[model samples]
Target: MKKILLGFIIMLSTLAYSQNELATSYAEKGRTLVMEKKYQEAVESFDKAIAINPKSALVFHHRGLAKANLKDDSGAILDYNVSIKLDDTDFEVFYNRGVSKYYLKDIESAIKDFDKSISLKSDFANSYLFRGYSYIELQKYSEAVKDLDKGLQLNPKSGSGYINRAIAHIMIGKNKEALDDADKSILYNPDDIRGYNIRGQAKAILEDYKSALEDFTEVINKKPDDAKAFFNRMAVRLNLEDKQGACSDYKMLKNLGEKPNSEMEEYCK
Candidate 1:
């Protein structure tokens, strides 16, 4: 009887080991599919892994990533919630869930998740960057500046971080600081139109109409159909006492399906 019991125990252990191996294989396949951008297929592979091992937090996390890539923010959040319940120690899971929440416009919840992620991994620059964006959306400019500044300190090459910081500075009426950040952003990514736009706005705020006009004109040269750039340039032109130039920009703005401001309407006519 003892020998028979030992044989049965060994058989059960072997079966469990095999099951775990199969689940791991499926999970690896899912990761490969995700890298290939085959998000739907990746989800199916993760599903098979989960079916074999429902306790696998890693599988659930991978499924959440696949869902996020497919733009299924709600579905991703669901899978991320399950993953977190299974294993709350992974900072990446919280960060990914925060991103999904951000896409869904659940800004407050996203900030909480980002806060948790930062708590788990204090050096995580992206968490700070995204949290700063959330603060900006909430119009907490000072808080946004603090987070963005920290993120940039961690990663000085981040153009998006500089751009966001510039925006926060602009909101607080610190146009000189905004101009500096915009210049840094443009230096990092010359093709980014927002950098030029922010710089122009900052210059305009400082009453540097000539430089502001040049910046706006540069934006128009890069993107000919940009109505906002035309409008900005028009305002600068009016400041420079160039009525003809302002009137031409006003016409272009209308052609781009954007209504001119009342001031522009009265002045241009």
Candidate 2:
């Protein structure tokens, strides 16, 4: 009986040690997978960590990120809620949860989360950026511009901020300001395809077909597989009465399995 009790204690000690080792290993692996953008795998690793240490708030937060990356916004929100319940001090959790809520179209809840995140960490540029985007979606252009300006002030190198701000400007009928912002965005990140796309859109709106065509051409060069770019270039060609060019772009769009609009059929045919 004594020998059995001793063996049982030894086994318990080994099991405890193994559990600790597994928690550490899983935590590390989860972090690595998150860095690699393999969010599903990261969630699995984080789940193992949480199983080993059920009280770990950080594990919940990590798993929340993985869920969010995989578009499981509801699951992500639940994880974030648990994490916040365990520990409300982590500002990043609120911010990330807000992003998930935004995608879920719970704008009010998302705004509240962003507000809480900003309250916890005032200088968070990304939090401000996302908040600004939410405001834009809610049709609050003035507020959107304010937060976007703050984000740009915090991180001037973020080309996306400029592009987003430009969109807000355009929505508010400040077309010239929008153009200026887009130009600056391109200056900040010359290779940003979105910047070119936005500039092309702005040029199209302005009826600058020549410049718009050039911008669309550049987009096609950057992304040959994009049917939208081909379709857009076709429109510009039609406007310019370049029938052959329009037909060629129309064929390309059709070959890429894109549904050409009636205008495309009328002009190209």
lDDT scores in order: 0.95, 0.90
Worst 10 residues of 1 by lDDT: 259-268
Question: lDDT: which candidate is best?
Answer: 1
Tens digits of per-residue lDDT for model 2 on 1-269? 99999999999999999998999899889999999999989999999898898778888998999899999999999999999999999999999999999999999789999999999999999899999989988999999999999999999888889989988988888777788788888999888876777777778778898998998899899999888788788888888999999899989988999876787688666
Q: Which pairs, if any, clash in model 2?
A: none
Question: Following a full C-alpha superposition, what root-mean-square deviation does model 1 have from the true structure?
Answer: 2.0
For residues 137-176, write the lDDT of model 1, one tens digit per residue.
Answer: 9999999999999999998988999999999999999999
Clash count in backbone of candidate 2:
0
* Number of clashing pairs per prediction, in order: 0, 0
The TM-score of predicted model 2 comes to 0.79
Off by over 4 Å in 1: 1-8, 260-266
